[model samples]
Target: MFKTIKNDLPASIVVFFVALPLCLGIALASGAPLFSGLIAGIIGGIVVGSLSGSKIGVSGPAAGLAAIVLTAIGTLGGYQNFLVAVVLGGIIQLLFGVLRAGVIGYYFPSSVIKGMLTGIGIIIILKQIPHFFGYDANPEGDFAFFQVDGENTFSDLFKTLKYITPGSALIGIMGLGILILWEKVLTKKAKIFKLIQGPLVAVVVGIIFYAITKSNDTLAIAQSHLVTVPIPEDTSSFFAQFSFPNFSVITKPEIWIVAFTIALVASLETLLCVEATDKLDPHKNVTPTNRELLAQGTGNILSGLIGGLPITQVIVRSSANIQSGGVSKMSAIIHGFFLLISVIVIPKLLNMIPLSVLAAILLVVGYKLAKPKLFKQMYDLGWKQSVPFTVTVLGIVFIDLLYGIGLGLGVGIIVILLKSYQNSHFLHIEDKSNGKHKIKMSFAEEVTFFNKGAILKELDSLPRDTYLELNLMNTRYLDNDVIEILEDFAVKAKERHIDIKLVSKRGVVENPESFIEFFRTRPKSNLSLS
Candidate 1:
């Protein structure tokens, strides 16, 4: 792991810059104390990264959990009380890992998973646009369709025209230009260019712009448009910011309900992020989901104890890490250390880093995730893969993360059923022999009841005077309902002047006594069609 320090160090700097404002923003959106977000960021990085099996994945206070935290804080009476729920939520996640519930993440369709990453990319772009132009009404981490700032995602874009800050927007455009130059040109020119990433450069330029333009009203970035980490004057004041959970509220039933909700949602988000990050990883490393849950649970427990929000594996940060060339978990660990040390040391300097620069950084991340080529690639794969992918993207862009996934999963299942119905068998027709229509129908590898409708239709549509062959040579598992259907069809064949033959690895049996018995006694084999 240490061997990749050159890569991990630079990646960590980029992730650190990406995570700082987000930690504060999510905490702001959650209505928690600003410092709490930093605490979660720190714990998520150090504790979770150290324990996690994932190399490129990063954990932090997630935007997905912001609303949950906001509601729980109010419903549970106060911030201190809410901490109890977070702690309990961590416990519940630990239990989930022990129960091996992490396997649930594997059940998602590939189309849906792709849709998720693309959808999140689009959301990131949309969410950052306002911030990019220095319209700082919404928190940087807000990813939902509807905003806490009384604007929907698109509406926010339109609103940006009315409040764009010239100074911030100028710097944002400059930052974007620098990122493009570094990524598209400079990095290929020299090894040193790779070490000093574009995001770090953009942030430094943003700080310099803020510093030098302080006297210029039109070009000077406003304080509201800059990073706002809580600045402590001394060590004691910094330590005082950490809040301890009010454990007395642990006995409340409402607290437990809140805890369970947090655990379930956070685990789901983490699992989905794990899937997305692993796909993005250049190394194609697999993360142990159960272990990830354990790491997140441990992180959350520590975060809550210190008055921080619930933690999850955040796709934005993880993807940024992967995109920035993170090779190991050390990148995540170092970013946490940065969060820990920076707030205690150079928070005043951090405050000078304009939000627009960070917004520009995120915009690049977003563009990569939702690249135009991906759309064509999915479309080229055909509707079976594309439809759910499209629906998931639309749902996520129009609704929210979990809702989008559910909608995509539902569409994916429908696609499966449709394909199942259509693929029940391959039918072939031959010239009439002995004044009878001859047909051969080969069953699929696995025939389930979902295919009953198609098979029944094919059998029912046969000519009155016909000879039909039921080919089981390549069929593996035949459903009882389907076998029963064939049994019924065989009975009706006598009246229609249709003769039926059962063909299997056991050999052909003309007018089998019982379709069900014949199939039950037959052996499945890799028999090629003749």
Candidate 2:
């Protein structure tokens, strides 16, 4: 891991900057003490990062969990009591790892997964626009359509325009321009630019802007518009920030319910992010999913014990790490150290940076995730792949993360069933002479109950005076449901004046005694179509 320190260190700094506001913002959204988010960030980085198989994925307090945490905290009595659930949740996740439940992550369709990444990217961009323009009405990191502040995502954007702060807009726009220039020009022109990223430069410039405009009334940025890390007046006050879980609530049934909920949700989110991170990894490394669950479980246990929110592998930080060129787990571990040291050694200096600058940085991240070309690409794949992808994107954009994924998966399953119905069997009309028709039907290699409807429809459509040949020449497995349909169709063939020829490995049978009796009397080895 240390071999890539040079690459990881720079990327870690960028992740550190990106993670700071998110930690605080998620905590704010969760209705928990702001410091709890920072603690989870610290543990998610140092503890989980060290143990996780993922080289580039970063774990932390997730925005996805904010709603759950908020409700759990309220129902469980208080934040301290809620910590008990977090700890138990970690234990359950560890058990899930032991049970090899991580395989469930692979069951999600690729279309839905891609949709999630794109949807999240779009959400980040839309949510950050308000912060970028200097309107801080919504707390930073609240990406849901319906925000906790009684305002929706689009409505807040309109509201931001009415009360924009000129200073914030100036710094944010300049910060974005600098980042773009640094990436496109400076990196190629000078070694110094490559060594130091644009985000770090943007932050330094933002701090300077804050200081320069301190005395100006109209151009000055408010304290609320800047990063807000809780500052401790002394060492004791710093230690006081950490809280211990209320162990007395361990036996409560409600506590167990919340624990299971967190375990399930956090594990699922972590596994999804793991897949996303692996896909985004430049080396295409596959992380061991079960180990990741174990690592996250351990991180959550320690975090809850010390009064931190539940932890999950978050895509935003992981994507930023990958985009910033993180090459190893060292990036994630080092970023955690940066978070710890920043709050302890330079809390005041950290507080001087503007939230709008961070928003600008995330805007770039968001654009990369939801590039317009991707929409065109998905559309060209045909509706079988495109419909679920489109639904997943819209679901995440308008509803929330989990619901959108569910909707997309639902659509994807329907597409599969439709295709199955269309591909079940092949039918041909061989002869239509005088007033008689000869029809031949061939079953697919493998036919299931889903093929029942199409076969039944064809049988029901047969004309009178037709000669029907039921062919199982290629069938290897015929489901009982389809077998029943064939048996019932044979009985009805006599009434329609249709002469039936049953063909299989058992040889031809003319007007078989009974479909079920013929099958029951046939030898097992001769049952399959040759």
lDDT of 1 by residue, 58-116 (tens): 99999998889988899999999999999999999999999999998998999999999
Question: Residue-wise lDDT of candidate 2 within 101-191, one digit each (tens)?
Answer: 9988898888888999999999999999999989988776577889898889899889988989999999999999999999989999998
Measured over all alpha carbons after superposition, the RMSD of each candidate to the real structure, in angstroms, is 2.6, 2.3
- What local distance difference test score does each model get? 0.92, 0.91
Clash pairs of candidate 2? Answer: none
Off by over 4 Å in 2: 433-436, 471-474, 502-510, 521-530
Model 2, position 52, has a per-residue lDDT of 97
Highest TM-score, which number? Answer: 1
